[model samples]
Target: MKMSREQKYRLIEEAGEEELALLKQQVKQSPWRQKYHIQPSTGLLNDPNGFAYYQGEYHLFYQWFPLGTDHGMKYWYHLKSADLSDWQDCGIGIAPGDPQDSHGAYSGSGLEHEGQLYLMYTGNTRDNNWIRHPYQCMAVMNADGQITKWDQPVIREVPSGYTDHFRDPKVWRAGEQFYCVIGAQRENGTGSIVVYRSPDLAQWEWAGELSTSLTAFGYMWECPDYFEIDGQGVLLFCPQGLQPESDKYRNIYQSGYVIGDRMNMNTLELQHGEFHELDYGFDFYAPQTTEGADGQRIIIGWMGLPDIEYPTDQQGWAHCLTLPRELHLRNGKLLQKPVPALADRRGSKASFSGRFTGRQQVPDFAGEAYELICTYTAEDEQDHVPNEQSAVTAGQASVFGVELRTGENEKTVIGYDAQTQKLTLDRSAAGKPFAESYGTTRSCVLDQPLRQLHIFVDVSSVEIFVNEGEAVFTSRIFPSRGSQGIVFFAENGAVHLQAEKWDYL
Candidate 1:
């Protein structure tokens, strides 16, 4: 059912106690509730916002619509964690009834200054004519965890050349000055990023549109994040209205990044390379990153996409945040590995090691919420010359992988094809189906030989890190509760394999 405008914009306070209680009951009854990932208790969650480490803890926020399970009247829902494995919910961090954020509080980033964390975000307001007017807003949080929004917007009106689509201000400090990059669209209908300069968090000045090679990319660019890793600059953003080209941009909206030399502060120009997707899966968007206390760059993405109706909507909640990943720049590509701290949540362990030729199932490896690590190596053959025919024969057996959440008539397959040199995730028969038009299988070509698979499976989602994060696939699946089987298979020939599984505590 489509939500009416009034229903969509209703404030949480306007809801009666019975209505709120019923919503909570519906969410608790949902079978798809996440085991370890950060999901809303009620209503909708999207776009990780204001992620930063401050005052001996990690502060993370997301755009939340608490009244229902649709994108309506977003508030900044807060969570804090001493370790990334466990999160403490802090309720609504920023409500949206003020004049600036009359409609909603949108996405942005967080920066820690002297003894405080500064949150810079987009305040979304709609006028009587139903047109958007976005404001670059600011709020400050003390070490005591109290937050206060400024009485006025830091950046008031949209600049001259861009449309009202300007939003998502990501602020960073360079040398003695603070800089911000905002997602924008030109009057000519092309997507771009704009820059703003501020010495303090309050007063700001428009520098100019960021100069990049991408002149006409998409219709709108949202959630722009800028950071430097190992002296290389990376700009991450979600560009909407992209048409599918080969295996790229397969989703309705795409979240990706471009790496290059650091931006020229004076000219605001970025000399960068091509855009590469952060995750290749059915559900990933609006990823936000923050540097840990030890200077490790870590990221968390919304585990669902925009404009897609998920099966969890009927349960009164939708979407979750991906497990936090540690980012590394290796050989000109960003490699993402699940944070090492996650090992703290590991429970009972299981292991299997052998030369397997066909399908094999380990009894202890089946579970709903667990982590699995498997490594495969081709067995060597003496006196057998490596030729095209021999390679073809080997490829047949090399086309091996695992099936997860298997039941009588459903399973999700994560397999690698040596012949095609591709890693594929197929959820066609996984469970209750939605978004079939977008296809069920997503595959990525591997530049190197496949050696390992590190997988994390929750109640309703999966995150696969292939070959030590050379490529990653993150997706949400809706399988029946009885589907708790894990099977491993190889075709035509024997291969050496070692595997381990650990249930999440």
Candidate 2:
């Protein structure tokens, strides 16, 4: 058995004055700041934790290493929002509050038991001999969302074959019973998920290991999340150290899901079919899932990759959550669509409804870094105007510009690509629009079924949710200060665009 969290609490210590000073300095100098979305404060942030809803407000907790972004003493950073666009930081919610967690308060989940909020987390510690210790624990929050220290760990360590690399507790309700899933590293260095059952929020009994993987899954599982959606179960996880099998696993790490049958607590076995990544992008990991008021299962992931250089470090801050996505299991695969609640940010009233046509951009509404969705005909290949090798042949993208403003003359651009059936991201278009791959294109499979792009941009990032969110392309773009024009262009053909704009103020 692992040391109880009560026993682990004796090792707590405030990070040294020098250590804390360094953290403050780094917070003031995060490389990703000024150009992208990040938690308002500093420190190292990883994994979206304790995402839950209570009393009508939405809460999002994250694994925060406040001593800069280098994974110092871990804490839980709290945020609350009524709408997804505007978020408020609630400060450190949980920390190395107990001796056993002197090392870190690892990732976990938040649950609503009765009227109170319950937090289940991993109490990570290091012994005098420097061996890693992880104790499974739970904490309760009063009506105010404040934690009353959970003195003891409910499950101390993994069974014999599992190592101390166990954490990331995801809890949910099954009928009248409370169940939890945790990522684990086996003694043999394999990744798997363990299960537990609890009648109330406090007491837990090990149900068994719910799922396991072979060598390809890497040595340890990071964030493990499971939920039922559209009559099917989806298990999401991030497996570390997985070598590329082929063209996949090409990123530094991968966050994906497996569509499976329900977890039979009695058998502790997962009846799974296929596995697919949640997003096909360079930065996405440690995803967390929570249920919405609409009875929808929505997921949010850390959009910053580990070991990757984030240019914003000079400004301070590292990563951010990708836009919230509503998860659905379509044909044995997990499909993520941006939540419908986001479109509510569509300000200035919707225009050009019922479909129309034109060779020009919409009138009266002109702004860069805005959202546009419209369906119209491309005047055909012969209708396009010639410009360099990129001639806009009728019916295709000849000119399109969505910009974001920082200074009087600064913005980012995400344009359309008709020849390649892709969308090009123009991070350099504001000034040096001709930089190498100045306009980066990505496959977006737009046709009759998906003729429009629901675009969202925040100065330095663009998330194009196409076909009502069926397919999504999220990337980071940094435009120069020389251009702030929200311009659009078309060739001889026409396109009817229904545009919406919002200030995330």
Candidate 3:
């Protein structure tokens, strides 16, 4: 049930004590719950919020609705990780109750200044007529991880010519000034990103919207994050109402970034190049990034998509954060690699290699939680043989990468089509029917010959980094627990293959 203003705040405190207790019990019986990913102990979780390194630990907050599986009475549930691989839940960071955030504490970013940690979030409130009033609110966290909301919002009111869809303020310090970029919508129903500047983090000034090269990008943009990678200013945001292209933007919504050399603070405009999708997969959105203690930019995103029905809802919980990834700018393209710290979770290892023509199941290479690296040398397209079971057209693929999470009746396939130069991840037979809105097949075009596929498989999610992060796919799959088989196959031609597997400890 949707929560009103009063009921949300009242339930926030009362539900905290009771809901968490029952959550611990509900999770034990949910087979789809992740063992290593960050997830809500109960209810629904979405949009990673206020991710920053503070004091001696890394703090990550998420949009949580603890009462049930649906969105209701949003709160910020805080969790701290010393190494980004092991996390400790720290309970509710901010709850909606006060006038500023009476309806919900929406998405935002985090900052650690001096000795205190601060969070700037969009406070969602609704009038009796059901009109939304968004407030860019601020809060602080002590060394112990306890949070205190500021007395009032630092930035109030939606600027003229924009709807109340303005929210998800991402704050970062640049030079001597602090700036925030929030997603907004114009009255004409176009999406934009607006910047706000503050010298002391209290008073904020309108910094205008970033200029777009396209005439119409999307209707509304949500969860905007502005930051610099290397020397390029990266503006990452999720845009709604974009039509799908031949091989891109096939999801209901898309999250991506445009890279530019400089951001003009006066006009709040970014002179950027072409837009690129951050992750090409069935489920990924609302990604946030923070600089690590070692000066590396680390990012984490919700592993599930919006407006889709997940199989986990019946188990009483849904959604999780993708494994933390390190961002890099390589050859003008953004590259995402799973952080090396995750190696600490590795328990055992297995290796195999061979020449395969059709398909071969790798012995002892089956598990719901492990990291797999598959390398294949594709034969010449004209020399390759065709398999009747393959969906790819003739002369398109000489070698197939591999498939994981395979069962007697189901499998999730990740393969390379040489003719089309497309890399595909197909989950049509992964078990359990889902909403028709959720697409089962996702593909990414490759410029060079297929070489390597780095994959991470959790209980219910799969993240594939192709060609050392040249392209990446992050998706959530609901295969049965017994569907843990892995196989490598090539159609019409023989290809050399080497596979390595590491199970999480």
Candidate 4:
């Protein structure tokens, strides 16, 4: 709904000279406004804030700056979904209209108490000396959905030795007392999580810090979530300052967790020394967790990185959330799969069993929008002949390729980069104007060996979840009219393919 005249005037009255300038700057900065791409109606958006499951629905609130592309005062943007795939955007939930949150209502989490939805977030503010201060606060919506916030900040401040960087509180109920973790920076200039205990959800008592390892992993950690997955505990967070570490940290920051043994609640101990990647993809970060109604530990994340320049920003919007993932411990490694409910939206099966030798130029079945899974491996051990490079030939990438094509106007070529020994995706062959607009080339190097590309392509968007959740590449392509037929090429290779089509109606 558009804002009423009265509402607009009220907004104007609420602003000062600086706020007015900032608002004008945000509106002026957009080169484009990306539609249906989950963007702020106005300013900048970052992490998904205040996420939880309630009333048979998954409610996800994100950082929203609806007036512009700048990271101005944030409001909690609301969306809820019953099946995790079809989402209902509920507009702004908690806004920065409150005086206590005049600066910005930063990142946090959501919970339900006494049949009421309660939100806890960092109340960001600047004091007289321009020092950053954070506060934990609460808000609730009545049964009718009319929202109201408490007058005072629930948890006023953290103890000394931790600077104003303390924020992004992730709260959960353990046994009876409510426990929460806040990202903090020590006086020594390192990052940590401070655990706190709150009995009534209002007042909080500071517990101790989690770790002071300072092992050079990353600077301040953001969005810390602790939960038990498959009888074991997992601590998930996005650590800042993490640089490229071999096959990891390829993106700006990382979204991952450490599986550990949970100690006493008051002590806040995690008895594990290892960290793992949450999703090895071009975009994924700031993951949060919630226990599903089915007793499964489910997770969701904000998919765009901070500080990295986004092409979409030119379109007057930025960022999106990753599909919800079900996390599990498999074979001593973390495993993730798209939530099952997404399959319900798969419409119909556009697939059939066929021996794909890549020689078959026909796609068997094709659609402007489709979901296809193609699997491949060496036809035999003898066929695993590596390229003549002394390195990859010395290691791997000696596998086969199962290529995909659409028409002279559109096609996607994919194969392993033999020299790098990494799986690669190619859209170089997606021809014509679409090819020219997209420059017809894209790819992502897989962390592990992937023998398949489980592709989900909507009319304009392509999301390739590689090898059953190992890695993903998401890209957008606009094609000329009447260029929708897809093809498969063996390209001196052989494999099995399943092409699934859906109406998405």
Best by TM-score: 1
Q: Is candidate 1 or candidate 2 better by lDDT?
A: 1
Per-residue error at 61 for model 2, in Å?
0.8
Best by lDDT: 1
Deviation of model 4 at 326, angstroms: 1.6
**What is each predicted model's overall lDDT from 0 to 1?**
0.90, 0.65, 0.84, 0.65
**What lDDT is obtained when candidate 2 is compared to the true structure?**
0.65
Where does the lowest 10-residue lDDT sum fall in candidate 2? 431-440
lDDT of 3 at 101: 85
lDDT of 3 at 16: 62
**lDDT of candidate 4 over 44-138, digit per residue (tens):** 57788777778888888888765444565677888887877778878878876565676777888888888877888888777677677788888
How many clashes does the backbone of model 2 have?
26
* 67-143 per-residue lDDT for model 2 (tens digits): 44444567888888885555787877887756767678888999887898888998987888888888888778778
Residue clash pairs of candidate 1: none
lDDT of 1: 0.90
lDDT by residue for model 3 (1-505), tens? 3445444445545766666677667766887877678888778899999999999789999999876677767899999999999998788989887889877899998998878888999998888888889999999988867788999999998999899999999999888899998999999999988888999888899877777675478999999988888878888899998999887899989999888877877767678888899999988999999999999999899987788878887666889999899999987778898998898998889999765678888777999999998876533456554332323334433647778888878898997867767889988887776755657798888756667789999888899998778888998888889999998888866666778999986
TM-score of 3: 0.93
Sliding window of 10 residues with minimal summed lDDT for model 1: 383-392
